[model samples]
Target: MTDEQQAVCEEVLAGPRSRLPAPLRAWLFRPELARRGQSLGAYARYGTCLAPHLSELAILVTARFWGSEYEWHAHKTEALKAGVPPAAIDAIEADAVPDLEDQQSRCVHDLVRELYASRTLSEESYRRGEAILGRDGMIDLVAIAGYYSFVAMTLNVFDIGVPEGAERPFGRGKARAEAL
Candidate 1:
């Protein structure tokens, strides 16, 4: 690695995460992009107005939508750690409606689902999401989805998979909807 790239990698290693994430590691070919992308991911994942669980729920939905195996494998643990129910996560992975009992989680899921399905949100979804998340939180929620979708695309395009012994979310004939 070039000195610049090594510097960027060190910066990433120094972040809250103990190691470099796959997406940021991939971005290291262009060190500037790696630095900026990691910064954006940090804010989206940790600095968002939405609660950690809500942001993680959006990320899980984005990973499922993109069929990004590495993304799903990584964030599923984070989602669980952030308090999203395992049943809800499994339902999402299976392409079924998660039995989300919390209004914020339900709102986040509905907004992301409707947007992905129709490429836009209905007025009802908008209103409900806004009511639950507030204006700033709603914006952060969308940004979280958008950012993770970018991460998912990077993982998918580069053919990144989970590390050895880690489960493949959509691999090994775990059938779900084809990637959108």
Candidate 2:
């Protein structure tokens, strides 16, 4: 690794992710992408108007949407730690609608689901999302989903997996729509 890239990696991963994540490690091959993604991910995750729990929920939805097992493995624990309900996590894993009660969580989930499923929100969904999340929160909600979708693509295309003996949370399967 170039000294500069190594430094960028260290600064971004100063916590439990002692090493670059597998997806980020792959990005080191393209150092600029890694650098920019590190900063963008930080903002999307920590600086977003969405709270930590809501951000994690968006990540979980993206992970499941792409069937990105490594993303799911990494973020499921984080989502739970950040207070995403276990039932919601499980429902996401099973490709079911999570019975979310918090209006923010519900709105975030519906926004992601509607966008991902239809590639555009219905007028009703768009208005509801705008009302529930406001302008900034709504934007952050989509940003988090878009960022994690890229992460999921990296993991899936690279065939990345969690470390050996670690359970794969999302499992290997076609997306729900694909199965029909």
Candidate 3:
């Protein structure tokens, strides 16, 4: 790493994240982008107005959309810790709409899925998002999805894997039927 790259690393490590994530490590190849991406990442992951469980749900949706194994493995536990139902996570992993009774969770799931499937939100989707999340929360929700999408793609293109011994979220996992 160049001196500039090392400095970027120091900046990221010194921030709230405290450690470099895999995407940031790859982005460090261009220190400038690393600097900016991490800044956005910090805000998306930490500064969002949405609750942690909602944030984690958005991330999981993004990971599933991209088939990002590393992202899924990393955030699945976080979603649970944030109080997301395991059944919802399992449904997401299985590429099915989760039977989320929570209006907010369902709103987030639909917003993200709409973003990916149509590349834009419909009037009704936007209305529901705004109604449930409000303007600021809606913004934060989109930002979370957008940022994690970038992270997921980075993990996929670089072939980043989950830690050894971690069950792969897709076919290699123990049994989806049980989780579902």
TM-scores for every candidate against the unseen true structure: 0.92, 0.88, 0.91
lDDT of each: 0.86, 0.83, 0.88
Rank by TM-score (best first): 1, 3, 2
* For model 2, the run of ten residues with the poorest summed lDDT: 171-180
Error at 20, model 3, angstroms: 1.2
lDDT of 3 by residue, 1-180 (tens): 899899988988888886788787579888999889989999998899999999999999999999988899989999999999999999999999999989999999999999999999999999989999999999999899889999988877766767668788774443333220
**Residues 1-180, model 2: lDDT tens digits:** 789788778877784345566677678778889888877787887788888899999999999899888888889999999999999999999999999989989998888988899988899988898898898888888889888888888888767776667887756643333210
**Top-scoring candidate (lDDT):** 3
- Runs with alpha carbons beyond 4 Å of true place in candidate 1: 172-180
Q: What does the lDDT read for residue 8 in candidate 2?
A: 74
Compare candidates 1 and 2 on TM-score and give the better one: 1
Top-down lDDT ranking: 3, 1, 2
Clashing pairs in 3: none
The lowest-lDDT stretch of 10 consecutive residues in candidate 3 is 171-180
